[model samples]
Structures are given as C-alpha cells and as structure tokens.
Target: MRVTEDGRGLQGSVAPTPPLQAVVWATGYGPAFDWIQVPVFDAAGEPRHQRGLTEAPGLAFLGLPWLHTRSSALMGGAGPDARYVVEALLKRT
Candidate 1:
C-alpha cells in the first residue's frame, strides 16, 4: 500500500475498502432535542440524562459525550460514568 499526499502536501494513505454490513455512524450530533419529547441520546449514541441519571427507576446511562467534558463518552471517561450510575442507584435506594 502506498500513501500519497494531497495537493496540500499532507501525508495520506489509501487502503482497500472493506465490505460493511451496516454503517451506523456515531459522528455525534448537535444540540437538537426540543422536538424530542422523550428520552434523548447524546453525542455518544447513548441516552442523555443528568450525569447518567435517567427518569426511569433503576435506569441510567454512562459514557455519554459532552456530559462532563468533551471526552466524557471516550474510554477514559468510563470511570466518571460509573460514578454517575452509582450515584443514581444510591438515590433510588
């Protein structure tokens, strides 16, 4: 495989495209939940709630993007998510 730079002289590479069964992109979304009069999903393709605290009993979320910071949904933010879930659970009890 050879990688060629574009006109801008930036390094790039080209690899054979692999077949995909589905293409559910998680590119994130903008703030658009006004019309959604129900549980909403945040930028991480997960349900949006206050620190993963869902209205449903015993239901919560974690690792949602833009929750705590821009990296909340990332792998590094799982700890925070866990905390939120635990807190919510505690509140329920």
Candidate 2:
C-alpha cells in the first residue's frame, strides 16, 4: 500500500496483485475520539459508558473493546451490544 498527501487529505493506493484470495490491511492504530467535543470521555480519552450507553443522552458506542464484556470487540459480541444500544435509541425517540 502506498499513501500520499494530496494537500487537502491523504490518499491510499494498492499495487495490482495476481489473483488474490484474501487481503488484509491493518492501520495499526486505535479509534480517534478527540473530534467529539463532548463530555463523554474519561481522563485517558476513552469513552465512558455503561453497557454501550454513554452519559451523553444522544451519544452511544457499540462494538468497542470491552464495552460490556470480554468479547465486546468481537463480531459475535457486537450483536448483543448493538441490540442493546438500538433498544436504548428506540426508547429515546
């Protein structure tokens, strides 16, 4: 993968490869939450929540690492957390 800065933003490109079965691109980083100008994060910049429900009424997080349980970041774990958050969202409206 090749990344270039185009003044306005960064552009990523991948060189052509022979018939591929799988491709995995790892950014080697974590999610950025600084852009969220809310009091939902803790001192370490991690979102503060309970079972995916944040202190902020309109804000909620899903599939985050250990958002509720050990498997919170796994695909199978997402279903339960997603359902919980969705239920909370529906109740809000």
**Candidate 1 structure quality by residue, lDDT tens digits, 1-93:** 211133112122444334322111122344333322334455654565676665544445555576667777677766766766676577575
Clashing pairs in 2: none
Model 2 whole-model lDDT (C-alpha atoms):
0.59
RMSD for each of the candidates? 14.9, 10.8
Worst 10 residues of 2 by lDDT: 20-29
Judged by lDDT, which candidate is best?
2
Tell me each candidate's TM-score: 0.45, 0.63
Misplaced by over 4 Å in model 1 are 1-48
Q: Encode model 2's per-residue lDDT on 14-89: one tens digit a residue.
A: 4333432221111123676644555777899887878777765546777688878887778778778777777876
Looking at model 1, residue 11 earns an lDDT score of: 26
| Backbone clashes in model 1, listed as residue pairs | none
